[model samples]
Target: IQHALSGLGYAAVKGVRQGKFFVLNLDGWGREEAQKQLERISKEVLTNPVIEEYRFEIVD
Candidate 1:
């Protein structure tokens, strides 16, 4: 797809990436606690640090 895009004159298409997006809902947690738990979950459970990456956002 990157090559095809470039062929179609999208010269700025230097790379293409694919990944999953997730929306998680947590109940009754404060922002600081949510951030800490999310960091732990992302690092130890959700993704592999060697090849994969993850991020999370907390919303009301």
Candidate 2:
């Protein structure tokens, strides 16, 4: 998809990667707190730090 789009003149969108997605349900946490928790969870459990990488964003 990335190659096809780039071939069609998409300069702004490049290096597209496909990955998995997961939605966790948590309650009572604000943006700042949720961010910290997500970071910790992502680093410690969600990804293998050595071979894999992960990122998260709040959708709600």
Candidate 3:
């Protein structure tokens, strides 16, 4: 993507990566529990740490 964009006059694009996004509605959970579950899910289920990275944000 970056290479193509740079060829197309986008000199400012240093790099480009594609990733997935998800929104999980945890019903009635507190911050601590949510954090724990999210961490476990991210490391164990959502991503392959060998090649992929993951991050999440919680919103009210």
For each candidate, what is the lDDT? 0.86, 0.87, 0.89
lDDT at position 31, candidate 2: 88
Identify the candidate with maximal TM-score.
3
Point out where model 3 deviates above 4 Å.
none
Best-first order by lDDT: 3, 2, 1
Please give the distance, in angstroms, between residue 14's alpha carbon in candidate 1 and its true position after superposition: 1.7
Candidate 2: tens digits of C-alpha lDDT, residues 19-56: 88779998999989999999999888888889887888
lDDT of 2 at 23: 90
Task: Select the stronger candidate by lDDT from 1 and 3.
Answer: 3
Worst 10 residues of 1 by lDDT: 20-29
Per-residue lDDT of candidate 1, residues 1-60 (tens digit): 899999999989899988987777888778999899889988887888899977787777
> Model 3 — TM-score against the truth?
0.85
- How well is each residue in 1-60 modelled by candidate 3, as lDDT tens digits? 898999999999998989898789898789988988999998998889899989889787
In terms of TM-score, how similar is model 1 to the real structure?
0.74
After the best TM-score superposition of candidate 1, give how far the Cα of residue 12 lies from its true spot, in angstroms. Answer: 4.4
Of 1 and 3, the candidate ahead on TM-score is 3
TM-score list, all predictions: 0.74, 0.63, 0.85
